[model samples]
Target: MNEPLTRQPEPEYMDLDDEAVVYAEADFADVNAAFVERLIELTPAPGPLLALDLGTGPADIPRRAVAARPGWRIVAQDASFAMLSIARRADRAMGLVQSDAKRLPFAPASFDLVFSNSILHHITNVEPFWAEVKRVAKPGAAVFLRDLARPDSAERAHAIVETYSGREPDLLKEEFYRSLLSAYTPGEIRGQLERAGLAMLDVALVTDRHVDIWGTVP
Candidate 1:
């Protein structure tokens, strides 16, 4: 496998096009719902749990989580005000916060469960993400994080985009390709976890283009 691209953060303005993102992500609900199911099955937190959804773009995954696991109050945060605005309109049950993932506003050990999907690739340096996640999660808190795994080569990345996003709009397909190039491999993620002292979390390739890191906060 060829190396992943040098990390490049997505443009800040991309999040402002909430409608475009929502449309692009419409077909991904089932797979994301499965992510929630696997997370719950892996770490069964008790009811009335406090959950944090970091980088909850459009809050699609969190919305699924709330429906599948009732009484689990969720505070979903994203840096984008436009995205949060759309999420708030779509679902009022969960609290919405506009905040950076690297510097959360919550108190230490404030959450029983923490999860994020497809957000890792967006961070140019992932250390702060690991730090903040560890800081806010309560001891033994369930954690589930997932992101697209970078392909071995540009050709492979193109194939992935063609296979998965062939029917999507031109802009969405191009964005997906860029995201694939920007994603990290499993080994890279393991290294990141070790450096962040988060190696205790179980890391695995859960799909062709996805890697999941899940376990309790240790």
Candidate 2:
């Protein structure tokens, strides 16, 4: 019998200048904007939300979120110095931290909101990622995580990439395909969340190629 599809892990960090540039240049404007809007709508009520963004590569999502809600105080965290440097160069985005997602340099229960976009699949050891999320978020903190869903096979992954990134640069398209291969399935991520004591959050497929794990921390 053929084995079920499995996640193909990729590098956890994009520390090189050219890699960071290729990623930062990719057009994620529509999806990133949608992520911010959906996150805002998910919050029960909002006034100066103290938000934490994990794996905030290039700082695009945080910047868009802050622009939509000026009261939000966001701190973007990434392990890649090159990515953060590009983010700063783009607009001098402040409060950026270059740290691994597993080792967040923040106090416990410190944030009203915790969110990440397209970062989950990059994590090789996902337990610490969710554990840190649960640890740093305040009680009842709104949590929204969006990531690509691993396709059933390489062919599907390539098709998804081509459909979405047809006009994108070759480098970007290749990276997108690799990311899809590396992304975790919904069941796998849910199990990870449960093991990390985050079973209360909801996990569901949000799109053909994406999964959204959302809801509030208990």
Candidate 3:
């Protein structure tokens, strides 16, 4: 059976009393930290790189990258004021902006590196996300985005949750399950990328439950 799509973003997610702590305590920071390491290795840009991080929940990825690379100026943005509030409390180094990813407040080609973590699945229509990613990114800008991949069936989704979030609290396990259902498969992401004129990006299954879109903007 096809898994039903379910997405809970921003206010609704933040309204949950456990949401903040769940994200704060989750073990996924290591995964995002690895993405940052890989991005630095792949990006050809030198020091003082201007970067934009979309949907920066608590700014964990930005925090990791900033600590490791002092020269990176990161503008971490999220649509949810609640999430931004949490991000602000987590780190003061990043410039936190509350803005929609589809219609960013910046000018064209404003950044050298654009990245996101697990934000794509929250978007119902992903075309706008890719369009905006291309618009804000400079020519040859490195992109590293990763998100959960929807399973082929609800049973598979349940199994994935059991495998990855079983040890977590009930709230987080449920949240992970919902995110998995909302996510797009690798094939779907490839189609969205092609439609958005981002066909050059490399779309791959980076993990059992996640798909990654990584490459330089053309």
Candidate 4:
């Protein structure tokens, strides 16, 4: 049996508008593009595939997924209504749904793929979140998770965020650090997936700070 360390209560302030959180500056476009390319490469199956973009901030992943594969149908869900509004306004292809990641409002085996980026660590309860993912995704469906790994110090995380966004995100800095403290190492992530009944396919450290864990539903 696998056990998660540092369990904490979910914070109310974590639900920020995706547009506000994501598009703090123009450079986020490049970041979004890079994530989109990675997601495309990870799942190359021809669509009419059903995709659920968990924490679909500003619906970037869903928008990019639709652009990459026109036959794909995306359910863009977020806990923030403001984010869903931004997503709906930005992309016509997305079906916007406001919901929490830990308790997805979908039927069992409802999706062919589930993708999330930089959102898992924000969640406080790992077990329920993974359980919901397993419930909603079909057997053999692909899951992609990208998040910051544990850092030696909060300063390192803040420095990276500052470098990426070109400004200090003071409000988000402490939260980011806390999230990292609770984040999974490569081994820990694979263990969590296996315990959640997901079959691991690949796990890679994309950068010193970021890790990508891909797996299939068993």
In order, the Cα lDDT scores of the candidates are 0.82, 0.89, 0.82, 0.72
On lDDT, the leading prediction is 2
Q: Provide the clashing-pair count of each candidate structure.
A: 1, 0, 0, 0
TM-scores, all candidates, are 0.92, 0.96, 0.90, 0.82
Give the range where candidate 2 is weakest over 10 consecutive residues by summed lDDT: 1-10
Candidate 2: how large is its RMSD?
1.2
- Worst 10-residue lDDT window, candidate 3: 8-17
Candidate 3: stretches off by over 4 Å:
1-17, 44-46
Candidate 2 lDDT over residue span 12-72, tens digit each: 8988888899999988999998899899899757578899999888999999888888889
Any idea what lDDT model 1 has? Answer: 0.82
User: Candidate 3 at residue 189, lDDT?
Assistant: 88
Write the residue-wise lDDT of candidate 3 on 1-218 in tens digits. 44454443323234343586677678886687777887788775557899999988888889888888888899998887767877887776569998888889999999999999888888876777789999999998989998888877778889999987789999888888888878888888899988999999999997888798998998
Which digits, one per residue and each the tens of the lDDT, describe model 1 over residues 1-218? 44555654565324647444644355886778788888679656547888999888778888888788887888999898777777788887769998889899999999999999888888876899899999999998988998999877778889998998798777777788888877888898999889988899988898899999988886
RMSD, every candidate, angstroms: 2.0, 1.2, 2.7, 4.2
Q: Model 4 off-target regions past 4 Å?
A: 1-26, 168-182, 199-201
